[model samples]
Target: MNKLLFIALCAASGTTCAQTPATNPMPDGSRDMYVGLGVQSAPRWDGTGSRKVSALPVLQVQWSNGLFISGMSAGMHLSTDPVIEYGPLLAVQPGRDASGTGRSADGVGTYGPSLIGPVPEPLAKFDARPTRLDGMDKIGTRLTGGVFANYYVTPQWRLTSSLLYGAGNDHDGARLDLGVQRLAVDLGGQHHVSLSAGVAVANRNYNQTYFGVTAAEAARSRFTRYDAGGGLQDAHVGVRWNWAWSPSWMLTSNVQAKRLLGSADKSPLAERSTNLTVSTAIAYRF
Candidate 1:
């Protein structure tokens, strides 16, 4: 196992999952990894007020070759500079069905095929619950390509941005995320906390697929027809705490709050414009 270290940040929202790992300088041919499971409570869907609890799987890894995978995202670090980092990125955008968003607590879904293969939606029993997406069309899982760049003013503060394309039912959707983070603040003993706040901007195709109600959809669903334009989709703030119990064991917990913006907040399917997602997991290093 690699030395005890903490070096990743990931935030999830209705529209996107942002995974940003700090650059780690490790020995050649070595790696650091963590894998575990936990639970998460989040809204049934993006705009729904109802919430559901499901299993949460934790996976984070970084190799000596400038490659890393955190949560559902994978990317390579091409910059050697200590102050700035940039590289190509690829991510799996979960699909959506009548029940809710394809990704469950464990990051599995079944609306369509994932480029990496599906993990099979587990909480299907939750389908019995009513959701605003009941009569909506199924959106396929998408493999999005993008780039990520981060600027560090110091080791503890960073500015982050990423642009990803290829989402939505038609696969023409795109999103850009911008945020600032205060990372790894020691709070006595083995506890550490990190904070972040960001905003996501999306294109018309993306917003429409997730929020708009077409005439046909309105006819079938309870919602009235509505058009959602491209713009700022949501703003979010998050905090994460890590408690290291040993060289190989640690508990990680996170809480995030998001509020829909612009047209996304006005969609008929949006029962609530604001929501919170909370999760906790225990991981073992390898």
Candidate 2:
């Protein structure tokens, strides 16, 4: 539930962050703040290939000194040139969901092992925890720190790239993402529309940790042993619309489509190669 406060922040595509007003009481320069009510639809876990859309709250803050905090990430902006801004970042990883296998929304598969009537027992010997019908593993939320750079080709068109490395048992790996984005602001001072496309690359340990299956697991779960060596994990494109409904409020909505790539798509745990997620929100801009 706490992830709510940071979802859109993590989804930051170098979105425009309003600066705080200099007149604010704090000795620090003015900082910008925002609060919004929204619904976020996303994959239940990194490789589950399942989607969930639920109520959420979104928050954003940008300090006057080029420091910013959003969804899963926090960073200090090192440079803010007309075309380039780079920074060091620290973020929380949204590890696997506690709910393992079942036919319900929580299951690894839509119907867990029952769909295939497989062995469905004893998750993994090395896992050291009681196995669930879903044959899935629990990954704790972890910290990933890295660097992010944004390049603006034009005032409205930009490129973003980031590399993240896990700091502990939570991830034990690394991931890289590159994004191309286009967005227009101040459309008559009332409308904003944005488009984004991206690709993500993951390492072998990163993919295996989530999508791979072991002989011990295959024997009990009835799933063939799979070793996923990651390369390109997924690709996605999205469109978003935002309208200033009033001086104090804005309305927003977006739809995103993504497809699994490479070995990640070959895993038995993946039921679909593609998925769609949509969300909308209203926020008070201050």
Candidate 3:
């Protein structure tokens, strides 16, 4: 009877040992660090008449433990137009010219001028002046960078948070986003494409700097700067395609769209400025 009890105990211990969880493998095989360069452009609908272009250089560093940091620097330019005016109107001309009429003997006649008294009072005042307005043709630059970390609660899931800053032209603002990323499974092998989806909330400061207005100039023009007051930004969902052209190089294309959910303008022109960006890049992973 003692022998039978010993055998049962041995069997239970073996089952428990077999149920132990397996340790997760590190990401990829080698150290994960990548550098990339690309160009991005968006069609301008801000009444600027010129298309905008951005030259972007990207850098990313990743660890085997799912932590990563990435950054991008971009120089942007808006095109110039000869006919578009950006400033306030300076002068105006009336529709009709009244000084070309000739005088005749009749007191009143069609297409003819009438005689005037010694102290003649003009029938109407004419303004034949030309109008002009201010224009914005200055070049602007933008710099943006952010750091993010991912924690893999499971082999296919991660939670992420990032902080971003944007400066230049009308894009001086900061953003904070917290979301989750998931790797979807495919029937293909490990080399198959991976898909990720997430949502983020952002806050923006729409000060005079965004309007191309200086503090002193704003005061003089009596233009009130728009304060967005930490409103709800936009939600985002994106997909990335990772193509391995060789062992050490990969190409990725990412497209994202963010719509402004709250008001962002204090001027007529600013009210028309919204943004959309699409980018593709090739990276060398080390």
Candidate 4:
């Protein structure tokens, strides 16, 4: 899967090599909408496993007046164990043990030698079970939408930023992206290629309680509730290539590298690792 994604990225970059910038015709007065489909994968960040694949569908609408909106949705089946570990001490109580052993339910079992007595029963039935926790095997979809504003820094340079919100069946988050794109213009008066790069940060929340603890009798032995809070999601760097195929049509390809940062593990559905993503699309302007 990684190989295939790499191949697609290569093709996109290779196409850029053939483009020779031309003069912008609709330069500052055009509106366009693009819809495309592609493939995506979330690979293990620790470098010890296989990559998972998914389907990606995206839509983007833009205007020369600097207003734009875009949306993307993808689905994947992935897994991870975001476990927090604690101590290994056993808990016992004094007096209740009948042998006068100095022990407590707070897990101070090694403070003294074991004494022959009836073990103090746990205050809570589930206290006998293990604590600390992690999550694994996540299958879900992620949907993202955003509005952007662009400013023309120069006839050939533009800066853009957007506020984005993302939601999933099992995952939800918000993101912000800031970037610049430049259209290289040659003397021929035809726009042939463009280059863009950006940085994005996101925050996501996971439904850990749904998968963490159980209230059912059959699951009582395997469940323990753990708090999973959201945090800085992922940071990414991306580049795109625009190839004008004709007067009103073009093919655009994008490649991005994403790194899971900060407390990403707090979200059970997050891969909580770094990955590289590449995609492509073809659009037309009227």
Against the true structure, whose TM-score is highest? 1
TM-score of each: 0.88, 0.75, 0.47, 0.44
lDDT of each residue in 151-195, candidate 4, tens digit only: 556655655444444432333545444555554433244333334
Clashing pairs in 3: 87-134, 91-131
1-286 per-residue lDDT for model 2 (tens digits): 1111111111421111111111112236877666677776655543344445577555556676777655345677777464676878766665453453111111000000001112123224324322232554555556677887777687566676777888224456777777766644445767766666777778888777667777776776645799999698777666656676776677766665666678887876555566555567777767
Clashing pairs in 2: 6-71, 9-71, 10-71, 20-30, 20-31, 20-32, 101-134
> lDDT for each of the candidates?
0.72, 0.53, 0.30, 0.32
Each prediction's RMSD to truth: 7.3, 9.7, 27.6, 21.5
lDDT of 1 by residue, 1-286 (tens): 2112333333564555657576788899998888889998877777677777888888878898889877777889999997998999888888878767755332211000001112122333334434547667888888888999989878777788889999987889998887777777789877877777778889999999999999999888777799999999887777777888987888888777777789998887777667777888898888
Task: Judge candidate 3 at residue 154 and give its lDDT.
Answer: 65
- Looking at candidate 3, the ten consecutive residues that score lowest on lDDT are 8-17
Candidate 2 segments exceeding 4 Å error: 1-28, 46-50, 98-133, 167-170, 185-188
lDDT of 3: 0.30
Deviation of model 1 at 98, angstroms = 1.1
For candidate 2, give the lDDT of residue 51. 49
Model 2 clash tally, residue pairs: 7
